[model samples]
Target: MRGRTLNDAFIILDEAQNTTIAQMKMFLTRIGFRSKTVVTGDVSQVDLPKDTKSGLIDCLEFVDKIKGVKISNFDSSDVVRHRIVRDIINAYDKRKK
Candidate 1:
């Protein structure tokens, strides 16, 4: 990760919540000069194994307090889909618990 350098690149990592913590650390450390990275994922929705820790959740714990990193969280109010979609999501969440 440290061996390579990316300059002026915009890196967007999707489905990052499924990544392992070790992989998240590697991706973060790979940032090079003038590179901007956006790691977007819902901590509540992880596709990894049941016992595995989400990389997105773990990474947020470490970098959320950093000065340059900005973390934005969206709720159902921000959902762009129909209301039924949000309700379906809520139902799934409820079922998980």
Candidate 2:
């Protein structure tokens, strides 16, 4: 993942919240011509060290103003797991506020 470029490929990076700022930048730069990349993460569920900044959150801030970048936000209603999962997410979200 260091020096290779992904060309004409579809790349998906899951759990992006676990990545560091520098890692996200490196991953994004690997995209080459005709490549489509998707990064998915739940900022609320980040597992990085407490002092570390989440790359997903950082990327969102910078890419929001860039052209050809689209961001989609989903709530607990989007949870497709067991019904209890959605309830749990909603409970935690409520507690956060």
Candidate 3:
């Protein structure tokens, strides 16, 4: 995803919370004509070094205002996995606050 542009492609970057700022920018800029990109991450679960900022969080700060860019947020209620998964997420969320 460095120098090549993705054309007519569907790219999904999962676990993006681990990406550094520069890596996120590079992944986003790789989008080309007729391509759709989806970046998924849980900010609370970011595994970057303490001093490193998460790219997904940084991108969300500005992408909402960009045309054709859609941001969808889902809570525990939207979890499609087993019930335990949603419960786990809820527990973590509660602890964060």
Identify the leading candidate in terms of TM-score: 2
**TM-score to native of every candidate shown:** 0.85, 0.95, 0.91
Q: Point out where model 3 deviates above 4 Å.
A: none
Q: Using lDDT as the measure, what is the rank order of every candidate, best first?
A: 2, 3, 1
Q: Write the per-residue lDDT of candidate 2 for residues 1-97, one digit (tens) a residue.
A: 9999999999999999999999999999899989999999999989999999999989988898888788899999998999999999989988989
Summarize candidate 3's per-residue lDDT along 1-97 as a digit string, tens digits.
Answer: 6789999999999999899999999999999999998889888889888999999989999999999999988899999999999999989889989
Evaluate all candidate structures by whole-model CA lDDT and list the values in order. 0.86, 0.93, 0.92
- Pairs in steric clash, model 3: none
Give the per-residue lDDT digits (tens) of candidate 1, residues 1-97.
5577667899888989999999988888888788999988987779899999998988887797788999888876688989998898788878989
Q: Give each model's clash number.
A: 0, 0, 0
Q: Which stretches of candidate 2 lie over 4 Å from their true place?
A: none
Give each prediction's root-mean-square deviation over alpha carbons. 2.0, 0.9, 1.2
